[model samples]
Target: MLKVQEIRELIKLVDQSNIEEFVYEHEGSKVEMKKKAGIAVPVAVSPSVQPVVQEVVHMEQKPVQTAALQTETKQEPAAAEAEQIDTSNLHQVVSPMVGTFYQSPSPETDAYVKQGSKVTKDSILCIVEAMKLFNEIEAEVEGEIVEILVKDGQLVEYGQPLFLVKPE
Candidate 1:
């Protein structure tokens, strides 16, 4: 089995290279990666892996283009709404790694922080679980929690905003 750091390094290498697909197998572990729409998605297959067969079908471009245009039009308002927010005074706390965001230490516990919660630099804000490891995320700045950007148990990408804080 590959270590987490090794997997992260592999991901970085694959992302930087021009290769569209990559596959690695050692012993019983298999790692498959592919680029789709310029995004690198990595999949780790277990020891007992089964080959997947996919069928490709040809489609007309005109209807797809029209649908894409309509989707873009519908998303314009959300962009406009986001532009109206004053983010100058807020500090974004971003995820340090790709993981599942957990608002509390456990399911039965209260959240570490919520809107209006005051925090110091050493305060624990949440936990980000990656590869069965629970990493405690801290409030790196002294501030009040302004917003929680993700929901509990949501998968988060590296450098993605997890919280907005109004710094004191």
Candidate 2:
């Protein structure tokens, strides 16, 4: 069993991590935490899963299985179009948080970045709205936008590949 303060700290860790869910149990007491809009939401304890404190790590990211992401019109994972893009020379910039993806700052504004657009490490490539806060997603690596794997206003999952970039 864990104390309230310990659980709270754990919640903060999970909320800030790339992992989606966490679980901790000792004897009879159990606690679960899942990220929901930069806040840790406690989940009702269930007997099925086993994890002391599940932090959402990027290693566990799986492209959400959805037809919208599997289309042939330039909206699939690099693996789906590997032969066409030559991913060996590209690196992916993924979503750091789960939220609504917005390509442009506003409906009337131009997109922050587009295909063939050059980007620096600090470029604001997109915005992710979570918990009513518009967080700017930046390009951590300099590159040219090779492909956008998602559409505007789509519900993006944590660690979802947002753009495939070819190193400059």
lDDT of each: 0.74, 0.72
* Candidate 2 C-alpha lDDT tens digits along 69-147: 6655554455567557777878899988877899999999999998889999999999988656889999888988998
TM-score of every prediction relative to native: 0.63, 0.54
| Candidate 1 lDDT over residue span 96-142, tens digit each | 99778999999999999998999999999999987678999999999
- Quote the positional error of residue 126 for candidate 2 in Å: 0.2
Give the Å error, residue 96, model 1: 1.0
Worst 10 residues of 2 by lDDT: 52-61
For residue 31, what is the lDDT in candidate 2? 74
Compute the lDDT for candidate 1: 0.74
Among all windows of 10 consecutive residues in model 1, the one with the lowest summed lDDT is 52-61
Error of 2 at 12 (Å): 18
